[model samples]
Target: MSSRPLEPKDPGLSFGGGARAVLPLTIAVAGFGISYGVLARSAGFPPLAAVVMSATTFAGSAQFASASILEGGGAVASAVTAAVLLNARYGPIGVTVAPVIEGGFWRRFLIAQLVVDESWAIAHRGDGRFDLRRLIGAGLVLYAAWTSSTAVGALGGEFLGDPNVLGLDAAFPALFLALLWPQLRNARAIAAALLGAGIASTLIPVAPPGVPIVAASVACLVGLRR
Candidate 1:
């Protein structure tokens, strides 16, 4: 007797599965978003501007760095430069995910906007394959969580008083560490991370706010040869 062929997975189900897969991460993302909103509000951004920035940029590190720079009375050029540097990692991410994205220019453009580290990581399957539906689903959920949390934080900033007093200031860095910790299973990755941390620590006092991060990113190149 001949066996029936396996049915392809439904796109909607796949998308929902992806969203559920990353649901835990969404909590951390919300915490980070709230921290960013508080920082932006403390940095003198109006409530509307802070929420708008989160909605439009949707880049946590870049937004944080820019807000910090601006708060310190840094030049607009410096703030822009810091944001660019922080976001430079997306260049390779966009390249890696490009083939999986299908559609017209506008659709592709929208997809590109969602290519953050978390979504990209969730979308990448082993063996050089990607799940496009997962990418879009995770991105949509993260974007919504981030923007909504930002609005919550911004609107409630005055009532929250100092985020540090509430211990919310540590949320972003702790979340980042949690994300990075899982990837440090190999010796090379550990080495790169330690090297980056050392470089960033050394530069923190001498360099501008984002320069150390940009410089520390060079340690990632060590993995290219492996």
Candidate 2:
């Protein structure tokens, strides 16, 4: 009798692998959280309010966009709109990993909270597979770092003064680059990445805050043709 083929082990998921994988970026995450706190404070968010936002929202770009609009005297509706638009990318991201997440409605709902850019990328196991354990682990650590740092920045906003002076703005970009570097493995991957970058660059000047990122991601559809 022929034996069944052995199953491949999940690359990561056990023993807090996901959490450890994302730890190196803790500093960057903290910097970004702090930057957001400062911006939120500058936008008139009270210290408790900013920390609560970080804890609850857990979305970096969306928070920043909303805070910026509020700072610019935009109405609450406008600020909420900006935030929703910036976070729209997660709709696609959520679908991508839906299959790997184990459990029913409530469990899944809670798990979904951890699916941020950093955790998603860190937990990705290539060929469209993701490790839920790693994702959860990374998300938990990142959440702690973000919420705590936001508290620090919010309370110390007066002393921190200008976030730009501390060069905190570079944190997210640098973290993105680090996450993206490992994915540029082949000609097709490189081409897709370059195309996405080109599209984003073209749209940045002409489009709204979140438009370029969402627009550029359309380039990834090129793979569907293959």
Best by lDDT: 2
Model 1 stretches with alpha carbons more than 4 Å out? 1-13, 158-226
Which tens-of-lDDT digit does each residue in 1-226 have in candidate 1? Answer: 0011112453433677558756767777777777788888888999889999988888988999999988898988988888987787677668778998898999999989987877776665533356888788889899999999898888784454444565555655664565465566677878888999999999989976656766887887776775
Tens-place lDDT per residue, model 2, 1-226, is: 0011112464445437778778877877787778788888989999999999998889988998899989999999999988888888888889988998878999999999989998987777655677788789999999999999899888884565555566666766776676667667766767878998999999889987777888877887878766
Worst 10 residues of 1 by lDDT: 1-10
Candidate 1: C-alpha RMSD to true structure equals 6.5
- Which predicted model would earn the best TM-score? 2
Please give the range of 10 consecutive residues that has the lowest summed lDDT in model 2. Answer: 1-10
> Which ranges in model 2 have alpha carbons more than 4 Å from their true place?
1-15, 161-168
Could you tell me the lDDT of residue 133 within candidate 1? 81
> Over the full model, what C-alpha lDDT does candidate 1 score relative to the true structure?
0.75
lDDT for each candidate structure: 0.75, 0.80
